[model samples]
Target: MALMITDECINCDVCEPECPNNAISQGAEIYEIDPNKCTECVGHYDEPQCQQVCPVDCIPLNPDRVESKDQLMDKFLKLTAQKS
Candidate 1:
């Protein structure tokens, strides 16, 4: 599943750089996660880096954007292919 930042986010800016997929960004109110770019760190790390670094525990899986580990891996591969 892709992770999302909620209103509880403190805007401390830690999570943005922690995301290996470059999925997190500062929104008008709080940081937002781009689901299309997010892989929940499947191909980059054992865990989601944004969730790991968020101080207020505001990052959580997006229930509406549910995806299997394999799906996340596919997304990661596709993203990398685009960059290459």
Candidate 2:
């Protein structure tokens, strides 16, 4: 599953740089995680970097946004398509 930032988010900006996929970004209301770009760090780390670095534990698994490992891998490939 991909992690999502809730309204509880302080806009602390703590989770932004921690995302390996660059999936987290400031949104109109709060920081938002792009499901298409999120990989939960599958290709880059042992865990989701944003959730790992979030001080408020605002990043949580999104059941509705769930994806299988293969799906996440596909998303990962799309995210790092250039992989330069």
Candidate 3:
């Protein structure tokens, strides 16, 4: 599943730089995660880097964009290919 930044986000700006996919960005109110670009760091790290760095613990799995590990890996591969 993709991750989401809830209203609890402090906008401290830690999470934005941690996203390997560049999925996290400053929204009108809080940081937002683009489901299309989010892989939960499946191909890049053991855990989601943004969640790890966020002080408020606002990042959570997006229920609306749920996906299996294989699906996430597929998305990661597709994103990787696009970059190449």
Candidate 4:
């Protein structure tokens, strides 16, 4: 599953830098995770980095979107496909 930033986010700008996929970005107020680019840190790290660094514990599974390991891998590939 992808991760979602809840309203509880402190806007402290902590989680943004931790995302290995660069999926997290600064939204109007809080950080926002782009589900299309999120792979739960599958190919880059042993675990999700945003979840590791979020101070308020506002990062959680995105209930609206769930994917299997292979599916996540596919997404990861797509995300990095354009990297130069």
Candidate 5:
């Protein structure tokens, strides 16, 4: 599943840089995660980097964008291909 930044986000700016997919961005109110770009760091790390760095613990799996590990890996491969 993709990750989401809830209203609990403090916007301390730590999570943005930690996202390998660059999915985290400053929204009108709080940081937002683009489900299309979010792979939950499946190909890049053992855990979601943003969630690890977020001080407020606002980052959570997005229920609306749930996916299996294989699906996430597929998304990661697609994103990786696009970069090249």
Candidate 6:
């Protein structure tokens, strides 16, 4: 599943640079995660880097955008292909 930043986010600016997929962006209020680009760090890290670095613990899986591990890997592969 893609992760999302909650309103509890303090805008700490730590998670943005940590995203391998560059899925996190500053929104009107807080940082937002683009589901299309987020693979929960599957292709890059064993764990979600953003979640590890978020001090507020506000990043959580987007339940509404639930996806299996294989789906996440597919997205990751597609993203890497676009870069090449």
Worst 10 contiguous positions by lDDT, candidate 4: 75-84
When sorted by lDDT, best at the front, the candidate numbers are 6, 3, 5, 1, 4, 2
Q: Clash number for every model? A: 0, 0, 0, 0, 0, 0
1-84: candidate 5 lDDT, tens digit per residue: 998989998889999998889998899998999999999999999999998998889998999998999999999999999999
Candidate 3 yields a Cα-based lDDT of 0.94
The top-ranked prediction according to lDDT is: 6
* Among all candidates shown, the one with the greatest TM-score: 6
TM-score comparison, 2 vs 6, better candidate: 6
TM-score of 4: 0.93
Candidate 2, after superposition: displacement of residue 25 in Å? 0.8
In model 2, the worst 10-residue window by lDDT is 75-84
Better of 3 and 5 by lDDT: 3
Candidate 6, 5-84: lDDT as tens digits? 99999999999999999999999999999999999999999999999999999999999999999999999999999999
Error of 2 at 5 (Å): 0.6
Candidate 4 local Cα displacement, residue 3, angstroms: 0.6
Provide the TM-score for each candidate, comma-separated: 0.97, 0.89, 0.98, 0.93, 0.98, 0.99
For every candidate in turn, the CA RMSD to the true structure comes to: 0.5, 1.3, 0.5, 1.0, 0.5, 0.4
Positional deviation of residue 23's Cα in model 2 after best superposition, in angstroms = 0.9
Assess candidate 5 and give its lDDT.
0.93
> In terms of lDDT, which candidate is stronger, 3 or 4?
3
Error of 5 at 3 (Å): 0.6
RMSD of 2: 1.3
For candidate 1, give the lDDT of residue 35.
99
Q: Could you tell me the lDDT of residue 46 within candidate 1?
A: 96
Tens-place lDDT per residue, model 4, 1-44, is 89899999989888888887888999998889999889999989
